[model samples]
Target chain A: MSPSKSPLIAVVDYGLGNLRSVSKALELTGAEVIVSSKPKDLLSASGVVFPGVGAFYRGMENLRERKLNSALFKIIKEGKPFLGICLGLQLLFTFSWEHGDTKGLDIIEGRVKRFEGNVKVPHMGWNQVKQTQDSSPKTKDLFQGIPDNSYFYFVHSYFVVPKDKSLIAATTEYGGEFTSCVCKENIFGVQFHPEKSGPLGLQILKNFIDIINDSQT
Target chain B: MFSKRIIPCLDVKDGRVVKGINFVNLRDAGSPTEQAKVYSNENADELVFLDITASSDHRKTMLEVVKATAEQVFIPFTVGGGIRNIEDIRTLLHAGADKVSINTAAVENPKLVKDASWEFGSQCIVVAIDAKRKKSVTSNQNPEWEVYTYGGRKPTGIDVVEWAREVESLGAGEILLTSMDRDGTKEGYDLELTRSVSEAVNIPVIASGGVGKLEHLYDGLTLGKADAVLAASIFHYGEYSIKQTKQYLKDKGIPIRL
Candidate 1:
């Protein structure tokens, strides 16, 4: 695929997110990116990404205010690939109990809950992720050719528990078994920050870009 | 699992690696790029280049040396000394440095730590502290050590442990603590100093200065609770190799990359 035809990945910047690092990582994979807060830019892109770092409620509220809620739903329903990272993943769940009872995107039938275990709250540093479901090209496409238990960087205080077990693409042992990654049809999310996961993280992004490029061919 | 790291630090002056006996009587080791390539071949996890001179003429020369060394060495490297502003950090990082270590500048202007962390992320900012034992003069004097700046030339008069906690809160990703008393002594790391600073901050602590043998590396990790061990004279003078040090640590059941 030509560089221009390769899907322009839209990294949504809703005024509060770590978009620079994510954008730089994607750019390293030879993917053209447009970091935009405009609904038109997000809707026109081939792939949409919801990248966030802070509270889920604030993120969802920003998206709704910008009319990106309808734009994202329309794009996802169109069967185009979508990736959610960290808070972006939490926003996909039905609701979150972070500061109060806050509703999420409800795209996936899951609830985001605070970490309740003996392990540390942030779950910082490097940790291993074990693959559970083999569906979705992201399973082998994103994590392709890597070791079964390759370590990825993680920094979070909450995790998602999908109501449907089929959506759980990977699980990791933090305090216990917790969903580290999830995928459903064209929608996918990772609890950990892949951009900061070092070489393994870079490979996952490369795979995602390759899949996007292949779709055009 | 994350493997433990072994690092070698080179004190550079006028674009050349220099080693001093007891922090004085400096002698040129070799070209910075040549020495860095040798360490890279030996499987050193990371390398630290500290510019020991304070000359403006030498700083530009060192920048060129860093660019050349970074071109040859692929492993993560940190450059320190006389970094006063964000532009200096940006220049070094653009020249292929994975991280930048700030000492005197960070202490002089604490806000620089936050600014650098914001600009290049927390993982790229490392704070280096030179600590020395303070003799108790009066009953009211604090028991903690004192912090020094300007290549250990001037005393900052700040409590070492307190300053470590403050810097970490200011957004330093890691702390490279060197014991001025034990440096170049080839005895062992100052476990008391290392343990004190490691316990003071949440970030990783790299123990530098006195690392004479393999046991010293293990001592830093196990006893001192250091995230990484840094040596100079032993590695620079060819007394020990990075591979040998890592092998010893691995054999001792310590988590290290071989």
Candidate 2:
């Protein structure tokens, strides 16, 4: 948050993850990124990000083994804003139904379920998200100046269904109305991979950084 | 929905853009970089640079040409020709090329497609297939087509339809299918070839070769179901600027960047 010191953000790297791209994107925003599997780095970081791809159970197992679970909970409890992407977002739910039952961070009440129907399993490519419940300051805060119905790059089949409908920030339609992003107090999660979303996606990251900058000030 | 794309393909040989007749009668089009700049200024939606000589020459020179072209052009550019491994893809990507196209190398070793996609995201990888229709020797041949490599010189004996699906599953984000029979003919794209490949794959299909007039471009998009139309002869010989072609398409209610 200090103008002179680069904002140090810890990207949780738990052996099986997409650490490099998440780190690169943060670096593009002029933030000092420290990719760490260590709990100590997570405790000391000003901002924390959980960027992941691939299966749900494996991602949770890696996070739990590395003890990132407790550290992340503590960081969020301290009201430090946290962002989760894809499996990162799915990890925040109470449980995921992928490859059997897998417990999540439980920061928000939700469950991840596989997309059902005749369509492709992995809902790939760009899809537009329709924003809902604009009352929350984080709504305007996280989305920033991006236009309504702006498309974000997506590559996932399972989506988050928040227990508290109030927590839902945006919804996108593939088979039906599914949660694309959710915000609860200091925590934020997105089901889409923003780094690969091109310019519009970069703006979302910029917005998150701006929020961090403002909160610290 | 996104606008349909009009792409100008520059087949580069020895760092210069060149055009050939059915993969022969090679003539210099211009400097690859210079030609790219012209396309960029002319409002071309995208540019494709095929290192036509990748198999015949050292790989480093192709990278150099890509580096130079990337420096001059701002719009998205896809580079192909002689990309053999992940390192080759990485080199071109680091040089500022938006996407890397793998053809012969992918057909030679199918693993290259998956490896490249894993190393760099699938969006950055494209598979270029040069296809030609086989004359019916017997009625039992099913009137099918075969895939050709080394600029349509060597037949792979692989069915064009089946190979397209395999590459798409291997995480190729798009397919650049060129019809050798239609190359330099200026009649139109091989609609049968384009439609078959487009239907076979879920990813975006780019129709290449035999684009003569604006209507041919339209046929590629409307009839052929190609997401993009890639032409060289029409654009290279100054028969039409990309802007004019785009305007023609747009006037016909086909979405295109003006």
Candidate 3:
């Protein structure tokens, strides 16, 4: 077992953050974890984890308020291993129609839309996430130890619709097939809360840390 | 597909899960952390820790338990009992509780729900309602479920269905609907009450209490139309593992994580 020399993963604390659980899981992956909202801390860190639970507009507003938005973009542009959860995943898209027209970070090309139809909004509970491709980068990197049709805890109404289908690392069918995970090289986004998804979730975090270790050596 | 959730509720008293019979009896099930670790691995959708004896010191102990569980178990869990204000919710959430359920406080001061939801999104604010069913004489419809608070010791004279709508409107992400009459009896869930509340609100309603058998879970999901089902004794006593319950639901053609 690797004894904490694993990588410094700065879990961005944007006020509305899931820091404790995320850091706990990250540390279990043997990575040194830091919860910081400052840009400098994120710059020095090996990886950044953006875990949020809130409305998309408010989340974006918070990132902007804390000036962490620019820091996030800097980290991502540098090709640092980035993992986004829930609202963090939704913020990666182009825009969301959550309450009204709200612009996102636009890192990934997609429109965040709410779950329409008779299927309930704020789709909460343990749902299955199927890997879109057998050997995609996200599959090789994130889903390394995770199996197909694995269940991850999800509690969100809005789902991302990335324009590029291949970017969809995984898909979970709530009312219909929506992108549950979006992966483009170093950038990985999961609509589910991995920090709260049990062993399968821990495995996903472990896989992310492994990606960090690989990039280092 | 969105699988129906099967939640196991842990009644925490003095940092240990105790039996449901009485509060003072204190038949220790196990450490909250260990039991949570077991359930996390068991593929349980979620876990709820109700602070039975919610003292100030007890709250601190529960926070430690929550931290320990968060370190070990990666799945989502909620903390309830004696959550009087937004500060309590904030402290619990910071300590790694995914969601915080407010029963007594929420009823006494409905603003707590709105305020908590405003501070920390509705997704994390779970308002637990312990409701008792009363036969409706004037209305020819079904019986009326009355809201009971203070751990089911006090009746608020509030309608269960109406209160559910109020909470949802106040930004409660979900409603933990517990049937007091059906609780611990193991007969089954209050399907009529469950269906009424489920139909009343747009937010997700979790049907809690009264779950004796595996079929009760199915009934909560199908017949009761609840988004999720919460049980305590069935899982705690080893009567059935989360695996057995999930398998039962899956066999019954309900979407569940195997």
| Clash-forming residue pairs, model 1 | none
Output the better candidate (2/3) by lDDT.
3
Q: How displaced is residue B209 in candidate 2, in Å? A: 3.8
Per-model clash counts, in order, read 0, 0, 1
Reference contacts preserved by each model: 0.04, 0.00, 0.82
Residue-by-residue lDDT tens digits, candidate 3, A1-217? 2233679999999988558889988898778999998999999999889889888988988999999878888999999999989998889989999889999999988899988887766788888888877547655778987888988899987889999887888888877888889888899999998888887888899989988877776
Two-way DockQ contest, 1 vs 3, winner = 3
Model 2: per-residue lDDT, tens digit, B117-224?
Answer: 765656677899988888863776555789999768899999999999999889787889989899889999999889999878777788988987989999999999
Model 3: per-residue Cα lDDT at residue A156: 88
Best by DockQ: 3
| Lowest lDDT block of 10, candidate 3 chain A | A132-141
Q: Summing lDDT over every window of 10 consecutive residues in candidate 2 chain A, give the lowest-scoring window.
A: A117-126
Task: Return the DockQ of model 3.
Answer: 0.77
lDDT of 3 by residue, B1-258 (tens): 678888888888888778532222233436877777677777888999988875676668888898888777888899988999888899899888999999999988999999998889888999999999775645776688799988789988899999999999999999999999999899999999899999988889999889889889899999999999999998877788899999989998998887
Computed on C-alphas against the true complex, the DockQ of each candidate is: 0.10, 0.09, 0.77
Q: Report how far residue B198 has shifted in candidate 2, in Å.
A: 2.7
Of the two candidates 2 and 3, the one with more favorable TM-score, higher being better, is 3
| Residues forming the 10-long window of minimal summed lDDT in candidate 3 chain B | B20-29
